[model samples]
Target: MRSVLAACLLLGLAHTARAEAPLTLRFVAPERYTDAQSRTGSGPTLRTTIGGLERIFRDLAGRTLHPGQSLTVDVLDVDLAGTDLPGAGPTAPRLVTDVTPPRLRLRYALRERGRVVLAAEETVTDINFLLRARPGGSSSLAYERDILAAWFGARIARREPPRG
Candidate 1:
């Protein structure tokens, strides 16, 4: 009887853990994304950029969401932080200017206990990205990650419903 009870308890715990999984990410028409590919010929490819974004979303949602909450993100477009300098070589760095901030267009649904609490199609950007202090300094997709973090904080962490 003790072993049976323990087995049932373990199964219940496993189910709860699975229920608490945080994020579901979908890339809609990735090939049509605005700037998901590497501008420099020698830099990370489109696949790499998308993969990095996925990791960022998962990490952010995991850390910010409540245990019984989950977020579903459908990525519609991505414009990275900078533009490649014109006539630059294949290995040249991108030009990070005040105007060329990171942008992400996505549709998201935040659910709690299988009920939709918030949903929106949002275009998130940080025009002052160059002026802000980036905590994840020099990391891959750092600028993009920062903007996403800000978006997550405003939209999900605060539990604010969509404005419009």
Candidate 2:
């Protein structure tokens, strides 16, 4: 009886110690401008590169990830194909420009069990932060980042978890 009870206890402890599998996600750029200026007083037709926008994504991800835990990012360029636009002229017909007309964009999605459970869209803005983070450590702003980091299997953080 003692051995049987000990065996059951060991099994229960092992099960409790087990962690869920880790999740992975591929990041991609969503359609939109990294930065754009209003044409209040028009001059010449113009466009801007999305280089600054990519930097914004990198910054956000870096902060959300487990401290030093480097995230594996597969950045897919944003698709802006078949968008209708008529030039500032009267006779100009609608034009469909390639999504990668200028600066490139990428999408970031969280994955686990070989599926994407959460996602978010971010565009590069010339002005200020493309998007703001939620209040506190709720990670409420983004479900993908918040949930995955907390429950995602395998510790990604290089530093020790914060002790309460």
Candidate 3:
């Protein structure tokens, strides 16, 4: 058993040595509002759920964002019950299967770009958001999809800029 364990550890170390560096995902926003509204919790209703939000992103962006390009999304803010925040609710940290059904709700605000990258404040939420960008060919939906994927720890997508 000891020999087998040693062999396994050696193999694992070899694989690790060869493993590629993880792709870095940047959260440029200074603040991110993450709201998780469970269907079986006391949370409020949201316009969209986490899985629904993920689907929307995939639909919008086609799932292949190259590198260097960015997608900007507007995170809405709301007051949510059962939060860790002070005065969050009568009963905070509620269970997922509680009789209190989690409605579609907006629980927090992501007011700054720096917060998103540095703090991970909004990564925790199951929410929907709008996007803004300069005039470009990729259309809003495509940009959104790419941005969403990037936010979910996927590789980035980029388009070559025009040149003479």
Worst 10 residues of 1 by lDDT: 84-93
- Candidate order by lDDT, decreasing, is 1, 3, 2
At residue 119, give the lDDT of candidate 3. Answer: 19
Worst 10-residue lDDT window for candidate 3 reads: 102-111
Error of 1 at 126 (Å): 1.2
lDDT of 3 by residue, 1-164 (tens): 99999999999998765442122222223133344443444433343333344455444444442332324343343223233334455334433222222222212221122232211234222233223322453331233343344444421233222122
Pairs that collide, model 1: none
Ranking by TM-score: 1, 2, 3
Writing each residue's lDDT as its tens digit, candidate 2 over 32-93 gives: 33222223222111122133323444555455554223334444443221222333443222
RMSD of each: 3.7, 16.8, 14.0
Query: What is residue 3's positional error in candidate 1, in angstroms?
Result: 19
lDDT for each residue of candidate 1 in 41-75, tens digit (9 for 90 to 100): 64556898899999999989978998778899999
Backbone clash total for model 3 is 34
Positional deviation of residue 155's Cα in model 3 after best superposition, in angstroms: 7.5
> Largest lDDT belongs to which candidate?
1
lDDT for 55 (candidate 3): 59
TM-score, candidate 2, is 0.26
TM-score of 3: 0.22
Off by over 4 Å in 1: 1-18, 39-42, 86-92, 162-164
Residue 133, model 3, lDDT: 26
